[model samples]
Target: MKRKDQMIGSAFLCALLCLLMAVSGCQSMEDQNYTVPAAEKSETVNLKFFGNKNEALNVVAIEEILKAYMEEYPDVNITYESVKGADYFDVLMKRIRSGNGDDIFMINHDTMLELMKTGELADLSGLPTIEDFSPGARSQMTFDGVVPFVPTSISAFGLYCNLGLLAENNLEVPETYAEFLAACEVFSEKDITPIVANNDISLKTLAISRGMFEVYKGGGAEKALEQMNADPSLLAEAMRPGFEMVHLFIDRGYVDAGRTLKTEKTKDDLADFATGSYPFMLTGAWASPRVAALNPGLNYKVYPYPAQEDGSVLVTNVDTRVAVNARSAHVEEAKKFLEYLTQKDVMWEFVDSQSSFSPLEDNRLSSDPAVQPLNAYMTNGRSILGTDSNLKYPIWDLSKESVRGLLKGQSVEEVLGDFEAGLKKSQPGGAQ
Candidate 1:
């Protein structure tokens, strides 16, 4: 009886041991196949972008780029908003001041200057893409050796010539200021309008082209700019040569100041030039597409402004520069997006969609045929920044007003004096 009971107990113990081993194996198998719950995975980061370009093409292009970025980085989400017309700056300032600005925003050179004063821009020196930009573009976006913004596109201001009209008159495109004047003289003698002038941008670009070559070129620009910034009155002397050119245009009947003052830019002037009667139109390369669409058969080409004695100079402005907000909650993510955006292929895609030149060093020449003539000037370093942000006063506005005075029959000295007086009044605690 005792032997039989021992056998039974041993058998029971073996069975219990076997059951424990089987349970352990099952737990091991479950552990091997376990996965983290979807809810506990990495959190998604959200970003917002604001821009001033609300055109259909701009909206579509940016949206497509953002979509591609999101697909590449599945953990990120971006929202884009844009304001149109002149009210964009005001709205942007209000949002920033209210501490509710977007993570990334588009700014012009003037807005960049204003933002720098308030420490609103993030330091983008760490970005590798900064080195990929053209030297001129990088320099324009740099302040005290620190880059705060990334330029996306560069807009060139040039003389839009009616190629058919020039061919009809047996004249070639002008290459120098002297040749430009000579062409204008011939057109005037033939009772044809030399240029279609307007109150906006026409004189401003002309003065910039002439003044940049005559006064701002070489190494003398720094001291002169400093002195002019200190006392705005000095700008008259610095700008006198260009102003004289404006005066001469009026005096020679090359442009009718009275009619020009009444003409609307990009509307009246653009229409008149499309008629193929005027030989020249002083405008930005941005207008080239519109000219083509307006008069598809009109043979035209945009050439660099004929400002130099030996050759022409291209007046360029870095447009639609993207800046990261210093106060953004997702700063790292924002910067990463900028890095993606400025990649050669992505940057070219955006710039080409806008019909502007890429700011990249390796891709300065535009694919657009109408603006191709200005590419040589850009390649040879004959380009100058039309909108210089370092100036203390609003140079564009001042130029417009000064040119307006000239068109209204005010002498160059009188216009300069008026400009000085206006500056003094705008100073702190000066006049209302």
Candidate 2:
């Protein structure tokens, strides 16, 4: 990472540290300062996770889980090569290809395809019962015909509205694209600025622009997949709206693009939301625990991303995947471990225990109240959705670059043109 990006990350951590200290429930599943648990003596099991979850919190919780696992297995010596979310994939991929990926590894949705190609993932079929798991996670674990890992946790992006802010403003949460834009208008005129977004292709905005387009191109996921596989340019036209929306958000002031360089960090949003410096956040479920923990008494709710088309609301599940490396020396054991993690009993426990949503049709694991509204929205069956298939290898290598450039003032058409060119260059069989 560049020095500037590193500095931004540091500032983000600093802000989060201050907010977590002051907020009531900011402690992650475990405190980073805690000691490792003493489990039953077991063989040294070496496994590594490349996840970028709450870095500090995940470290302890993950260690604890391994401790419990070791208690049962009693012969596992787990070696972790964990990296914080900061430049996680960049570091993880290098380690993995060099024959150093953990016994098991965690990856973002974006890199799953390339990782799968290295034949490093283990097939998790019949290893665990996932019929009760969320389809989104199940599908993500499998690329093409190969099922690699188990679904552990899900991350969702939606509205983080401050009920108090709305009540004071005499406003109801917007239900359509127009209402949403209107709400922003009201907030901006009130000099409230109304939103605290990082503005640089991060969560909320990234979903609205890229991920949403991936899903909203609607009724065409399969086709889009084929198109990208054959000739990426064939799908460029469908991507125009995604590019336009990024520009739209900035032009309409839904996001202050001018401040993007300084605020493109999650910590910035967390700080503003906690201090009531901003009342609305266009983020994901990852922020839910923070809201609940920080202001137990505050009134807040999550809403589906508003859409321009009536009844055209779409959701793109972009995170939550676990995969095994086909080349792993302990592929069999890794398979069993991942299967255990996805068992209905285990998956639900993981979801509830961690305060998250499961894509499983099983109603047993309840949702975080903030995003419960999705149940009704999803139940209505009016939603057309898709997963973050962009992680499907070198095909999408240009994804972030194309989007980042578009957001940084390049033309949508030009970005797509360049993206198609890059896609052709990177295709295994070569573009048609």
Q: How well is each residue in 282-326 modelled by candidate 2, as lDDT tens digits?
A: 765556666676767778876666655453353535345777777
Tell me the deviation in Å of residue 329 in model 2.
Answer: 2.7
How do the predictions measure up, each by TM-score? 0.80, 0.77
lDDT of 1 by residue, 53-92 (tens): 6656567889999999999999999999998644677899
Model 1 bad stretches (over 4 Å): 1-46, 54-59, 83-87, 98-100, 189-192, 219-234, 251-253, 256-269, 308-310, 389-393, 418-432
Error of 1 at 129 (Å): 1.1
Which prediction has the highest TM-score against the true structure?
1
Off by over 4 Å in 2: 1-43, 55-64, 79-81, 130-140, 199-220, 311-314, 361-367, 382-399, 429-432
